[model samples]
Target: MSENDPLLNDPLLDEPQARRRWWKPSFDRRRILRWSLRGVVALLVIAALYYPVGMLLVHKIDDDPDFQAPATPEGASRAVALAAALIDREVGDYGWPSNDPFFMPGWALDNMPNYQQGIIAALARFSTEMRDQIGRVRGTSQVDPDLEKAAGQLSYSPTVWIFDFSTSWAPTASSEQQYLAAAKTLRSFNNRLSQGQAVFERRADNLQGTLDRIAADLGSASAVLDKQVEEHSGDWVDFQADDIFYATKGRLYAYGLLLRDLGTDFAPVIAERDLKAAWAQMVETFRVASTLDPLVVVNGRPDAFMRPSHLAAQGFFLLRARTQLREISNILQK
Candidate 1:
């Protein structure tokens, strides 16, 4: 028990710091391994749920065939009202996913973006026609300012996001902003038309010109379908088929609605020309084409029995509609 005792002053007891250093590293290694295992498991869990959950939250086609525009204001152009309503529904109600950023779930989506862009393209064309032909009393007359603005805004690229790296590093107006502004301008034009301050000439010639432009657009879409079918047909997994399909569907859907309302807008011309039946058939064909929502798009040969080419089927309807449009345009010329 004495401090000077040889047994109490052993060398092992005097070097406790060395023992502590040896054990400390072992403890630290075990702690690091445990944390690393937990980190890996957490990452695995996130990776497992990231795509499926994100896709569920973000994916929506919104291809409602029977979608009706808000009731047109009395004395306002029905077609203008429909155009504005379609833009509002897509941008505000349905949410524009075509311009989603890389971090968003929609950025990974292909079909929906194609479909939405298709819809916008059709609307842009319609707006251009409105500015050039429908909104003027004659070719020499001044263009309506609101219609010109709407046409320009609607024609903006659908793929632009809040920041466009290709053109500029700074922030820019997004596709949604541009489309919504177009919608606003369309509403303004409609308001002015209702108040007798704007021109929406519903003459037979204007209707014929509008139909001609629309038929030309349909011809182009049909050609796209034709090219896709001709090249990629009978592939078991044709990746590009769905993109073309949905884009065409979106275009047809928008045109169907627009032309339907335009029929009401120019009913007097239609009745006078006795082209009501042909116009109805054309709209019906577009309706059928727009509603072709296959679970999987197959680019089978046009004559293949087992895997029929959806593109070919869609082309059939597209061409039929285009033909009907031409027939109606001819009748209006009489």
Candidate 2:
């Protein structure tokens, strides 16, 4: 019992201190493990809901074949107004999904992105035609500054987000921003057109040339469909089929609307050339083609009995529309 006695300093006397140290560490570890597991489970629940809910909210494919643009102001080109309206509806209203970052819900959407990009592509093509042919007096005439700007902006890559690491590390314009700019420029061009300060040639030759260009584009799209059907037919699950189908649908839908309005714009030419029936036929063909929506896109063999090839069906309509366009162009030439 003396202060420095060896017998009094026995290891057993320190048992309470040792047990306290061991028990404190054990309790702390259990508490930390329980909290870590709870954190992991909470993250899992959030991640599980993130994409599904996000996709449900963000996914929209507005393939309304009968959709019409709001009426243009008096003297404005209806086709031009329609183009601007389409751009606004896609980029501003629905939100351009093709350029969304991985963190966004739109990034998970494949069909909507492809479809919207396809609409933009068609609009870009039409703007080019406007700048080069329709919006000018002749081939040698200077391009309209607004139309030219719109064309260039609309042609910007649809997949570029805020940052394009391919070109530079700096933050760049997103696709939606470029498209919105294009829409603004298009409206500017239309405003100038309404004021008679811009040229929108309604001559027969100009109409013929524009229709010819659209026909060529449809031909190219048909070729793509042909290739896709030839190569990937009969797959149980054709992942690429839906992309191609929706993109083509978008293009056809846009072209159908534009051509419908352009008919009104070129009414004098269409009437003078005795092309009312032909023009109507071509526009109707585009309308019908644009409305072909399948619940599921299947790339079945063209000759398959059980599964039908939607691509082939779409190609048939595309070719028919192109042929009708060519017939109308021939009549316009005459």
The C-alpha RMSD of each candidate to the native structure, in angstroms, is 3.4, 4.3
Most accurate candidate by TM-score: 1
lDDT (10s digit) by residue, model 1, range 1-334: 3567554456666545544544564458788999999999999999878877887787778877677777766778888888888889888877787888777777778888888888889999999999999899899999999999999999999989999999999999999999999999999998898899999888999998998998999899988988888888988888899999999998999999999989999989888888788888888898998999899899999999799899999999989888888988888888
Q: How would you encode candidate 2's per-residue C-alpha lDDT over 1-334 as one tens digit per residue? A: 3456544456675755654554564358788999999999999999999998999899988877667778787788989888989999988999987988889888899988988877888899899999899889988888899999999999999999999999999999998899999989989888888888999888988888988999898888988898999889998998999999889988898998999999999989888888888888888988888888788888999899999999999889989998998888888888
lDDT of 2: 0.88
lDDT of each: 0.88, 0.88
Report how far residue 52 has shifted in candidate 1, in Å: 2.6
Give candidate 2's TM-score. Answer: 0.90
Candidate 1 at 34: error in angstroms?
A: 3.7
